[model samples]
Target chain A: MTIVSYIFLIIGAMFFLLGGLGVLRMPDTFNRIQAGTKATTLGAFSIVIGVIFGSVENHLDWIPKLIIIIVFIAISSPIGSSTIAKATYRSKNIPDNLVQDDFKKRGENQ
Target chain B: MKYLITFITLLVVYLFLAGFVIEEVILGSFVSAVLTILLANRLNFKVDWHFPLKLIKFIFVYIPVFIWKLILANIDVARRVLSFKIPLNPGIVKVKTNLKGDLGKLTLANSITLTPGTLSIDVEDDCIYVHTIDVKKSSKDQNQKEISGPFEKILGGIFE
Candidate 1:
């Protein structure tokens, strides 16, 4: 169980690193948001699951707290990303090289 | 009905956290009742006889698929980020959804954001504008199918 938890922790750390790197490497705001949000959400989830496994051997009481944390992250992370994406779009900070942009065609931003 | 459901859910969660001690149960009931009375009207989703069935479907069917896709999404991100020459053909494309309910649309948007290579930017009328890391399919219908096919189908069953 400890070994499994350690493996998950390592995986989670690696994903977090990837998320940071992606945010730095991506060309524009939207791409950075996508990379940062997706990678970090999964990274945190993996770490929480790791903690749950690591502690379940000691006591069952910790399960609810950990589960609540997981649920909170799952609910909040996507919403946060969506809200940021909308804000970025509204601000007209979008990239010119977008291969397709239906939002522009719809005249929603202006 | 909504108030009752909210109160019950709150009480259950409190009891789960508090381990059903007598004092905690009484306190939880009081707090849940107060909260339900105050907040029930803000709870948008309707609860009916079908709620339990929908909940079961959400847990048994929807959760597994979401988790699987979440794993795939992380793997996709890992691949994109780790490559020295990152492959990206990014775009914002519109996809129409058949779901009418707000909750259904919200779920679809959130799921799309979390899933592989797609992030939902805006939802307008029956169409969602999605930011795709790779613009594999240019047609709107194909984009709609590729992005939200399974989610829309399952969520339609649950939320609609």
Candidate 2:
């Protein structure tokens, strides 16, 4: 159990690192949101699961609290990313050389 | 009915967080009752004969699919970020959904954002504008089926 927990923790840390690197490397706001949100969401979930495993024997009650945390993250993270993406688009920080842009047409008409 | 639902949901959440202690459960029930009275009417949901079926499907089917897609999304992101060229042909394209319910549409948008290379930018009526990190240049356009993939069909069965 200890080994298993450690493995999950390590994996989570690696993903966190990747998310930071992605934020720095991506060209624009939307892409950075994509990398940052997805990677960190998974990373946090992994770390929580690790905590559950690590503490399960002595603290079974922690499981439900951890599950609640996971549920909250699953709900809130995407909403945050979506809001940022919308704000970025509305503020005209859109990237050049987009292959297709249907939003532009809709934005103009509306 | 709305009050009952809200009360029960809140109580359950409280109990889970409080570790089901005797005093905590009592306190939780009290708080939940007050909150339910105040907030019941604000939440919008429908309960019908299909409610149980939808709940089962959401738990058994939809969750697994979403998790699998999440893993794939991370791997895809990792590959792109790690690559030397960071190959990207990003774009925002519209995809249409037939779901009429607010919850259904919201779930669809969130699912798109968390899965694969797609992030939902905005939703307008029946359509969602998605930002894709790697747009297929061949088609020059995106369709609902390609962007949403398997989710729409399952979501339709559950939410609609």
Report DockQ per prediction, comma-separated: 0.76, 0.85
Q: Write the per-residue lDDT of candidate 1 for residues A1-110, one digit (tens) a residue.
A: 99999999999998999999999998888889999999999899989999988998987778887888888899899999999999998897888878878777887454
lDDT for position B158 in model 1 = 87
Model 1 C-alpha lDDT per residue in residues B1-160, reported as the tens digit of each score: 7777888999989987777579998999999999998898778875678878888999998999998998899899888888888898889888889999887888889899999999998888898989998887646677778989989889988887
* Candidate 2 local Cα displacement, residue A30, angstroms: 1.4
Query: Which CAPRI category fits model 1?
Result: medium
Lowest lDDT block of 10, candidate 2 chain B: B137-146
For each candidate, give its TM-score against the true structure.
0.92, 0.94
When summed lDDT is taken over every stretch of 10 residues in candidate 1 chain B, the lowest stretch is B136-145
